[model samples]
Target: MSPAETALPDLVDSHCHLDFPDLVGELPEVIARARAAGVGRMVTICTRLKNEPAVRAIAEAHAPVFYAAGTHPMSAAEEPLATVGELVALARHPKFVGIGETGLDYHYTAESRAIQQVSLRLHIEAAQETGLPLIIHSRDADQDMEAILAEGMARKPYACVMHCFSSGPRLAEAALEMGFTLSISGIAAFPKSQELRDIFLRTPLDRLVLETDSPYLAPPPHRGKRNEPAYVAHTARALAPLFGLSLPEFAARTTANFDRLFPRAAGAQQAA
Candidate 1:
């Protein structure tokens, strides 16, 4: 049988994008499949400030779903910078467990470097104030990413996670040193990702979490297909042995890690 069909233990998809067109209309079915595959919980990340309402509603409508919203790095320049006050207010909602999937992304929009940096700092402030973990998306700009995160953290420490962590070892170490978490995505499960998997292996077990990054980065047997929370199993299975744990143990470890970083999620309200 293919990796996709491998049995999975109960898990939480620490990050996903159920608000995007790819999953929104089919949400109920999408969620059902996720549950069936042992993906018992998910945090749907909203990349744009403008779409917070829609994303929030998705969380409210589904009992197992929680949501977070912030300006994505790639869209930072096009959108207005976020403020700490605004984000803190949003965090009042019980299900708003995380802040910004906000970080540097020079891969596609290097021209917006200045604007992105400004936006990123603001999101950092928001996370600092709200006391919610910042969900970062670092890409080709590892140097700047490391510098800025360190600078902000120096001023005031805050919880953070390197969402979809796929950068070089330097950035990984920087994030890890700062007491931040590194999320494991399908990229870690890809056959050619020995280097990436090595980074995860070196990370402290307590600081690792799992995510699907749904509608993208599908794991083996599902790679190149639209990813969903259900496929998180394949990625989890790939890393379990590397950690010398059974799939159930790895799932529990990651899910417990998620609960620590996102306390609001475990006890979120049933409806909005």
Candidate 2:
């Protein structure tokens, strides 16, 4: 099938770094491209609490663009850990719909485990306070990630999403058991990512979210270039056959998942 004829659904790029260098300078064009490509909505994820004003500005600049507030696990070492009050306060903004891009990562040695945990806990507390979902990123620390999330979820009920999920089935099972949603990224579209695709196919659509993790992980045909929200269409195409759903159906289901997790977005969608 030609790239454009793959029959993309009205997908959502649930996680992206639109505020980063590649797209920030031309957000108008970037968003236009995404809209043209049938991306119905997107979440410009936050990697640092301190940069939230910038994040909010981007979200506020355009319709269907929402912001998330939290520090990335790798950024925890460079940025000050977010406190519960700070995170809660930031997330209270109307344009802010979630708390995270935070979780565990041992992929890089730049951050210590202690710092990541502290930040993760604060973000979780913020999610509890604001009733927003928590976005999580984990790598090579499944045991610690599971333990910390288990501990935090015990304190209060809160929504959580394992963003850019690349963990084993055990971690996936645990996260699902704790009521956390699992987001599949464009990595699933790669030839070597069959295992990831297998897991994604097995995952229930009700608890599944599709993300591009844009400015990175662009799916096939655009795999080597910096990704944008528009490329999320590629993920939906890649996912269709695996799940036995038509493209439009896949899009509708994932978009529904997005709305369910971010109630504020659901409200906005309804009002619009």
Candidate 3:
């Protein structure tokens, strides 16, 4: 391995869509490439409850892959709104570790705001009831997201991570204070994302995790190309210098952060 290649530690793609056609068509190859790049585990995120079977199948078919069950805000109208009991039943599977990829996304469409709020609350209630961590996706709706999250936390405490955070410092601080972790994606590696990088730089490493949001936001040198789990290493490499740590150190810390935030997965790892 080249020095840079060797520098990659056993990393985790905390969020990815392996169920999507782009990567699903070549599942074995995708997993192999990720393995070659030192990705020890990957969580194939579910964007719709309707696809829960496929998502669960992907995780069941792979040794180091797990899955989450939730509806994405963008697809809220497409699937039935999740209930705490329904989501809890779905999460009973061995590899299921989280309750959502659900939250507000006002950038795309404002027409679904009410539906989005209802859907998001369902996922949050499920997380609280089951004690499973939530994986949230918020975009251009930070105020609504924070209000809803704060309200949810007040009802009952549950762990959650803000996936692909590209929000302002206020939202970041609010989420952090609520004990929510922040996950940085390949977007943080973009040139115009210095503001995001600065926000991440200020956050504690223990509350920071890494992801690719794959088949989507590939980091530098791979920008505009279809991203994959292997590219998460690049995101980690970018964060290493920002955090003043070696690549291995950053990977280890983020991996630990991922594990701590998703205790069910950690328990599964120990049992395995």
Assess each prediction's global lDDT (C-alpha) against the native: 0.90, 0.86, 0.89
1-272, model 1: which lDDT tens digit per residue? 65633765869999999998889889989999998888889999999988999999998889999999889999988888888788888889988999978998899999999989998898899888888999999889999999999998999999999999999999999999999999999999999999999999889999999999998999998999999999998899889999999888899899888889998876443321
Clashing pairs in 1: none
TM-scores for the candidates: 0.95, 0.94, 0.95
Candidate 1 lDDT at 235 equals 94
Poorly placed runs, candidate 2 (over 4 Å): 1-8, 267-272
Q: Between 2 and 3, whose lDDT is larger?
A: 3
Instruction: Give one digit per residue, the lDDT tens place, for model 2 in 19-95.
Output: 99988998888988888788878899989877888889888878879989788998888898788888878876888
lDDT of 3 by residue, 117-142 (tens): 99999999999988899889998998
Q: Which runs of model 1 end up more than 4 angstroms from their true locations?
A: 1-8, 267-272
CA RMSD per model (angstroms)? 3.2, 2.8, 2.3
- Candidate closest to the true structure, highest TM-score: 3
Inter-residue clash pairs, candidate 3:
none
Task: For residue 94, give model 1's deviation from the true position in Å.
Answer: 0.8
Model 2 weakest 10-residue run by lDDT: 263-272
Clashing pairs for model 2 are none
